[model samples]
Target: MPDLAYYASLPRTRGAAAALLLDDLGRVLLVKPTYKEGWFLPGGVIEAGESPLAACVRECEEELGLVPRLDGLVCVDWGPPRDGVDAVNVFVFAGSLTAAEIAAIRLPPDELSDHVLVAPEKVPELAPPHVSRRMEPSLRGLVEHRAVYLEDGREPGYGSAPLASAPRPGGPG
Candidate 1:
């Protein structure tokens, strides 16, 4: 076994959770962050001791002022270190909102400036490339009822096939 010091010396990856919320018309809900340049899914970093799902729920409420029923894991994307930043693992959970919920969305003026419901194909134009790449598998996962694992928003292999199996409750089969 590795010594405690050796284990502590291993690189650490940051965790973030986001929600893939869709409206009744199947348009995705995207939020514009006051601190960021482009639009993004409604979510933020995972705080210490918080599970991904819990963080997703909390961020949705904080950013949009709506409690969303996150259905299940849609994608687990591993982002490689880039631009001098450390690696980050982003967990995206799937959910949908009713017309009432959509109308009730209220953004925090200090954090989010606006929100919009756009077709999936239009997401690439508003969100950054990394976010856009992740959205593809996420949307497919929602329709296929399976979770996908990605590296930098794409499957590990050369093609679009999923590299990892859908996660099970107890363990992977």
Candidate 2:
């Protein structure tokens, strides 16, 4: 077995923050990135020394050109290691956009190509499976006014168990 010091010396987990921005029509905002396939929430990787909430705000500004005040976290997912890539911790927060705010969206062409307000039910069809997993529960949390935990974009309880505090700033939970 690895010693405690060995475990402590392991590389730190990376984190990303995203928001589920709902419009008055109860639709969620999805972004098309220039660099990747499928639609994604308006967020990006959290920079070092940045809090997840701050990262969400910054990413929204950069990708969607909207300054939004996010509410408390809705979901925190512990993504599993995959395809040789390091595991990541993803934080999802909830924000709402007025019709005027939606109209004012000006996406950064370099990073994002398009933005759309998708109905909650259609999110599963529009987003990748894992992303949809994270998004669906997050929407529920927003409506239910509670927080939830996930593992690899799934509600903890099955293949991947959920954690009380999954992705903390300093390291993985």
Candidate 3:
């Protein structure tokens, strides 16, 4: 086994988790952060020792004041190093919200400014490119009951088999 120091010296990768929430109309729910320029999905960075699904649920509650019953995994994207940041992994979960849940949304004034439900196709217009690229595949995965793997938000080469029936890490919603 590698020494503790040796293991500690290995590169560390960051993780983040987000949810793809939809309304009964099939419109995607997006949030506008006070600290950021563009809209984002309801999510945030994964804290130490926290699972992606847990992080997603926590973030949703923190940002939107609601805990949604997330469905299966939608996408697992490996974001390449860019700018001055190291590579990071992002996990997206899918779920739908009832009218009551939508009505209960309450943004933290310091963190988020507003929330909107938009057509999936319009995601590209509001979100950053990296986030936009994940939308299509994530939406498709939700519809196909599969999970997609992406590199820098795009599938690599010919793409691998869809994890349609694979056991998801987080149990069912």
Candidate 4:
């Protein structure tokens, strides 16, 4: 948690936001926001009618332009933990996309300037405090082990491709 100043700066509630942490070969994925020069994890506020998990999945897809398998839920941070309505709960999840899948994405222009894969040491200097806190330690552990399991799950990796039936953002039956 950091300063509660931003909370007072915003309206009662900006709603909710979700975060995803993914690492590849010791490089953590990050976004250089167009709105602000600072780097950040791929995430966004949950729209009304969207579940937090759904928002986590959708934000990554929207920010990175790809749908990744959510490996696990890492941590949750709420602001009391930022002023007016200092309630921000950040859902940190372990998520990943293969090399081929990463190649297909194009960053959404309204949100980002560019995406980069950088080491943990570089993150603190490059990203915001909130983002760095969420990303750095996980990344460090991965590098130490030299191979991170990420989570307990069954994702086929880059081998056999199976069509996913995940829900599209802002759509309903």
Best model number under lDDT: 3
lDDT at residue 31 of model 3 (Cα atoms): 95
**Candidates ranked by lDDT:** 3, 1, 2, 4
Cα lDDT tens digits for candidate 1, 1-173: 65999878987679999999998899999999998799999998999889999999999999989889888999999988889988899999999999999999999999999999999999999999999999989999988999999999997874454535555589956
Task: Provide TM-scores for the models.
Answer: 0.86, 0.84, 0.88, 0.64
Stretches off by above 4 angstroms in model 3 are: 158-173
Lowest lDDT sum, 10 consecutive residues, model 2, at 157-166
- Report, for all candidates in order, the number of backbone clashes: 0, 0, 0, 3
Model 3, span 1-173: residue lDDT tens:
75999888988889999999999999999999998799999999999899999999999999989899899899999998898988899999999999999999999999999999999999999999999999999999999999999998898874364556545689763
Kindly report which residue pairs in candidate 3 clash with one another.
none
Model 3 worst lDDT window (10 residues): 158-167
lDDT at 114 for candidate 2? 93
Higher lDDT: candidate 1 or 4? Answer: 1
Backbone clash pairs in model 1 (N, Cα, C under 3 Å; residues 3+ apart or in different chains), count: 0
Model 4 ranges with Cα > 4 A deviation: 1-15, 81-85, 137-173
Query: What are the Cα lDDT values of the candidates?
Result: 0.92, 0.86, 0.93, 0.63
Over 51-123, each residue of candidate 4 has an lDDT whose tens digit, in order, gives 7788888888788777777765555555343435455655566666678766876898877889887776788
RMSD of each: 5.0, 7.2, 6.5, 15.1
